[model samples]
Target: MRALRCPVVELRQYTLHPGQRDVLIDLFDQEFVETQEAVGMTVLGQFRDLDDPDRFVWLRGFDDMPRRADALESFYGGPVWHAHRDRANATMIDSDDVLLLRPASARGGFPAPPGARQAPGEPAASPPSLLLATIWYGHGPFDTPFVEFFERRVRPVLTEAGGEPLAYLRSEHAPNTFPALPVRMNEEVFVWFARFADEGRIDDHLNRLRHSAHWSEEVLPAVSQRWARTPQRLRLAPTERSVLR
Candidate 1:
């Protein structure tokens, strides 16, 4: 069977109360998954930020802008959210500033199911974790050369150094339909997710990229010329029930 096409995606990062990240994750995994999907949205994956214990990250997708509106309204307005909204809100310190995104092209989205999962308390090498990178552009729509430059020039190096490219995305242009949940507005960005064998492998891959003349001399110049800010890298580990694992 063909995988579902999730055209519009939200990369949500929540800042939780210091000790409440796990509490929220448990509530989310146990109660939120199937319910949200039933309301016309795809619960792509839920993750724990390996680097930040108090931060929770997850992704959800929709068919299009209008569908996203319908799904959000149905899910958040329904009994499930109403019952658990206060509990969920209590765990979070901040829930706004979400990145609204879409696949860069037809070939630029997530991989199919049977994703690998890292066993709890196990060493990093036991199972691979995903590396999610958010590359911020200067402003507005991304230019063709910038996309081509990354794919043609930067991607090969990452692949050669043990990175498995998953998705290439750009910020979505549609206005936020769910006013209750604010998305980062008018932001220009490109995001990519890749898989690596372990944290060490990601480190090694980045080290190689930095040492290589191609990255430092060629790619750096192009990136510097266009990027609005330094790229943000989030090293994430899939939760036990995460589909993207």
Candidate 2:
């Protein structure tokens, strides 16, 4: 496969078993929701390995070369990160390595032009877009508070991250999917996509989201204890534009 030149470069690391994924989530959620925003970490994407159980992944970005380099330096070397880094490192198995994702839509944003622009009377063109998805089961009663969080917190954070307000949708309603790693989708999965002016905007949009104020406090409280057991996340860059726009 070709290396995608997505505008948003998602960076992640997957730790192995005997390692507590939820424990890591708990210990790092603050740094995740908070520090990422502060450190100028661009996108804060979360996910579960569909095929590999308990394999969790996170996605975030940087717009330019300097910002990307700076965020990494701050995350790995800053004093604010020391404790969380220690905890995450201590809890994980050695096999895990960080992964990067840049959806095709975003890739179009590279030095390459994102195809052609619309003609004068032609239907408005649908620019390529990418959706970051999180799937987890709704354990009955937790639904109310969770719903509330989705409305009040999650949406705004996503809006801020994207730098554009994207219409939110359900997995079934939106129904856009790529080959996911592997996991049972029983939970109240939430889906949202960010549209770019061109494919390249994807990375810039994500970078802004990591810097958003609401990304952490908005979603972290609702994260359940069992979250570690089912940390599923995936990203899809749609090949065909959905008619919803």
Candidate 3:
């Protein structure tokens, strides 16, 4: 298992000025990865929203809460960001209110990137696109039993429905460090991102899952009782340069 170097994570969803997603992805993939990691953060993975052309979703990590402040201060204050921040900001209509997170357990963090973060001008790897489903539970502090239930029950249901579970994560409860860039405060949520072959397959899978006796008899009851609200779902596809693909 790869060590989860970053105990603190940020799930950032950005609403871009129409058709500017690729423009920002180009800047991000070309210039942002190693530069931020050079200071202290890990650029985990970047993705394109298959359902929405104007949305970009990415993850970044830090060793701990304090480190998050130091890393952001350094990277955003550094020359690369200074030179490119305007362009990046220009692409986005909104970038704040990210989900602050950490690994649910020791083994719950992201897999290491295939190689070291790519430098500018390096050829990025081309991996097949996978349908990423992010299900966000409105309440969190999802404990051992809940995680076990998800893996043992919900995951198998999703698998049977043609969705492959990729990662499961819970909200990080650490105090906000860089208040300037705020995460949703006082929220308790766990998120799972899974992969499917296509949108039609996902629709089919959900239908099957709904009709499955086990899902109706046990899974739905457990989930409804645990989660505070209906789980919010996001359909994401990898960008050409995304590592998670």
- On lDDT, the leading prediction is 1
Clashing pairs in 1: 115-245, 116-245
* Candidate 2 lDDT by residue in tens digits, 1-245: 23333234443446656547666655554455556547765433354443445555555555544565566676667676676666776666653243332332221222322344232235536644454444443344234455456556665666666544332222221111211222223334333344455435556766665665555454554555424346444443422212212
Error of 2 at 116 (Å): 33
- lDDT comparison, 1 vs 2, better candidate: 1
lDDT of 1 by residue, 1-245 (tens): 23536989999999999999989988997789888989999888888888899999999999988888899999998999999999999999998848998877666777666644334344433344666565666645666667787788877866776665788888887888877789987888888888775788878878887788877887778777767777788888877667775
Q: What are the Cα lDDT values of the candidates?
A: 0.80, 0.45, 0.79
Q: Give TM per candidate.
A: 0.90, 0.40, 0.88
Clashes of 2: 21
- In model 1, what is the error at residue 168, expressed in angstroms? 0.9
Worst 10 residues of 2 by lDDT: 173-182
Highest TM-score model number: 1
lDDT for model 1: 0.80
**Cα lDDT of model 3 by residue, 1-245, tens digit:** 66775688898999999989999999998889878889998877888887789999998889888889999999887899999999999999999849988777665667665665345566655545565656556655688887788878887887776765766788887788988797886787887777666677778877988888988897888888777777777777766656666
TM-score of 1: 0.90
